[model samples]
Target: MQTISAPRADARTPVETPAPLLHSIVLDWYRENARDLPWRTPEASPWAVMVSEFMLQQTPVKRVLPAYAAWLERWPTPARLAADAPGEAVRMWGRLGYPRRALRLHAAATAIVERHGGRVPDDHAELLALPGVGEYTAAAVASFAFKQRHAVLDTNVRRVFARAVTGVEYPANATTAAERRVATGLLPAADEVAAEWAVAVMELGALVCTARSPECGGCPLRAQCAWQRAGCPPHQGPARRGQSYEGTDRQVRGKLLAVLRAQHGPVPRGQLDVVWPDDIQRDRALDGLVADGLVEPLADGYFQLPQ
Candidate 1:
């Protein structure tokens, strides 16, 4: 294996990434070891890829699989989903957590139908213009769905770059301009190959370079990893911690939504009040849900998901 140089201070001129070797090793590993995800299939339409990206945000693959299947089964096309009430989208979202993504996806589908004739647009700029389509989601859709050249910097890809090239155990708490430059620099020159490279790196991070308990011995990048070369040093930056779900407002919100989801039509305020113990906390959670458009208030103090 060829020894790649270390990354320099100026990320704009990053020359440490041996693009050819990295692509070769990672892509080969991906071909053999990549998860058989529905979205990665050649038959997966751009709409399917768009849906996966939305659901996968902060949600795990195992949890997303069944929901994804059911979602596509019911609404395979953007037009199909767009035609349904936004409340149905939220209901279909189930216990996926972060129900706001459901509403955003519905809005995006509506925009797709209106703007692009019900087809998910291949143009990166056009994708970015859609509702709930941010930089990461737009790039992911363009590359994965359309095989276009773009740096798809999700958390997984960022962690891979941090350890493999930048000699760090983790990336910054938030994405930096420097990180974007590093990602762009590592991209292959060819559009289709670059798309493959992006997913390969992402897969590498997801499988072998995980945030905790990485299986470094099995990692394709193990030999070339800068963090490994540096003796697998500990994270020197701010302390990393996982978010607590129990007893939090998010739990209360989920519980409140569950009741609304189970019922057919509008639910009375008193029914919602029984889910949580504290009156103040339950009221706050319900109010937050209403403000977020996840719940619609009806006449006579009844509530339901958005119509």
Candidate 2:
């Protein structure tokens, strides 16, 4: 147990988080209310967990469900995915929104096969070293898949903490060192407990303490929530912008990639032209895609997934 101290201004002292109340109430509520997500089950392999992490990024659970199953079915192992072309990975990605994640997951699988014998690394640092894996993803895979004790601060978890503990409507647009430090302090001392708490907090945020229209009356933490006690003030922080897809370069790229994903081999440039009408924007999107390594341009001007 940590020695409780009054608030300090020093960097060494982490800001106090609601420790026992957070740990117990959240865990118990999670056991009763948590959705039976497949990836969290005992049968899911570490690779399955890793793949789920990759597919879940910015994409909704409903959208990712079928893609995750099909992706794993085709390339069950990291080596299998690594052996295939990037185009195949992108193609398998379907309409997952961010096709780049598929490409990065492929790259990560390649790295895993090459460096770690196809096993998703259990160590946080090693996981972070893998392509497409960031601090949150690394910690998530390690703690959730490997049962390591780590603070998994995803968007949902951050929102939960912001409301329940920090008395804020939302966390900063970006994560901060202070936020991480507080998360670390909030972790249960027991490894297994800490691991469970990580997912529990995340599930609470996802299902209950959502970004908008939180079901506070139904929430177990409602009585203890600081934001509620503080009269639920509106967010005074910078505007969190929503992404737009219509007529943007991203939409053009998606259209272009759709043409290629439908084909097993290289497609002629003319096929891509019909996806988008404006020649200048379409060309820019294609050029950006090729430059980003998501699409490959052959000597004959045909396009395909990277070999």
Candidate 3:
């Protein structure tokens, strides 16, 4: 995949404030049509919101729903998760893929327990300092969970901004410094309003301004959308690369983890060897898992999830 060359921050054009009607329209649509996701519920805890953000990274919402519920039901708070063995987190993660996220969540839970008194912090910097919480996750938890005024720029929100504000079919392949300025400029002045605006824009993109086939007719911003006004041009930049699963190390890792997860304790090295035929790839996958802290080896020829 070609790297997208975004203009330097100084050279980028300023983003105009979206019309007030734009907010009302999108917000109203969100209020009515937004998916009844558990994370968005009034009763959802800050921890729940943060967990959802972690699970939703590259995974879809549908796959996340059951896992998210089971996770919280088992470990209702950061303290609970922190107290449990890390292997349990991995087991409960259950085919979510990128099982390392489960490990990171466990680490983050431990950090929250030690640093924040088991509370998911509202402060962006504190959230960022937690394991696996990056700029987007921190902003998401701060904005969606705590209702703080931060620019929450995920893939969905970026798509919304690209089409509605920038008249582009897609955002730059990478989140550039200039994109940060665009999000900042368009943020509402009032903190509460800005928070609502953030999620509203994200919801719009998820439901309406979708990546491959946007349902433009149902979009609240269709009438005023820049992309619509300009006749919705196709993406002209570098070709987007599709993630291939076949014959990949990721697939091998998942197969290895599945074997581990099916058992209650350590498995013999020979047991793991039978999952994949390629000796080198299988060995590389096992080594990668051990390096990632997802697997631990005993003095004997037995492998287990981290204790």
Candidate 4:
């Protein structure tokens, strides 16, 4: 998929303020108000953190809580999940949406078992080499789970960096070298503190510097925030919009997957056909699913979640 190139940072991006002061404020705020997410708990394993990262992509914490709990309870380790059929992962994914993530995660588990002695590797390069892990996931697992001093740039952290330092209402559509420099420059000197700072900034963005309806009045960074100082200027880039799902191909795909997920084995074509009225759209969605390896076509005229 093509992505819009990120604009280079210019004079508008503010010079970062004192790092220690910035760290202290956000870290304190996080200590007081961070959500009691299961992934953040001391007892959470590396595999547990990796699972949470996968489930939390483009998905809210509220929706992920139950699924995360159920998933860990069922397959507590990479070896355990690696032993199961990939189809089982899709079934266990439930209605959290984005079923393809399930397949990638299952594949990652299998790789971990095969190459890392059933352990989720702490090394960023090894993490990135995993099936579903990308730059953000790699940085996230390294920082959050291993207490490494890497810049963990996710949506929330990017938003925080944009508004607080870049004097913008939003980050660019794509992650940029400028954004990485800003994130890296602000990292705390110590590895452990940098890890804590990464999560703290993310928590602040999630709870206070939110996408819509940000509670700036209560934000600890209000005094120094570039966007706030600039009167919270509106987004100057292309019109920002949320993804539409109703009546989209994604919706049709979800419905078809629902039928497959419910059954124990391959479903008849006739049974899958009833999920949508438009045969063209439904067939296209099913074909896309099969092409994506989220579904498998059997010798018989039937489909099922990939084995």
TM-score of each: 0.94, 0.93, 0.93, 0.94
Give the runs in model 4 whose Cα sits over 4 Å from its true position.
Answer: 1-16
| 3 against 4, candidate with superior lDDT | 4
> In model 1, which runs have C-alpha deviations exceeding 4 angstroms?
1-4, 7-17
lDDT of 4 at 178: 93
On a 0 to 100 scale, what is the lDDT of residue 89 in model 2?
90
What Cα-based lDDT does every candidate model obtain?
A: 0.91, 0.88, 0.88, 0.91
Question: Residue by residue across 148-190, what tens digits does model 4's lDDT show?
Answer: 9999999999999899888899999889999998899889889
**Candidate 2 residue-wise lDDT, 236-260, digit = tens:** 9578897877889999998998888
Give candidates' CA RMSD values in order: 3.3, 3.8, 5.1, 4.9
> Lowest summed-lDDT stretch of 10 residues in model 4?
1-10
Identify the candidate with maximal lDDT.
1
Indicate which candidate wins on TM-score: 1
For 116-184, candidate 3 gives per-residue lDDT tens digits of 998999999999999999999999999988888998999998998788777889998889887787788
**Residue 160 displacement (Å), model 4:** 0.7
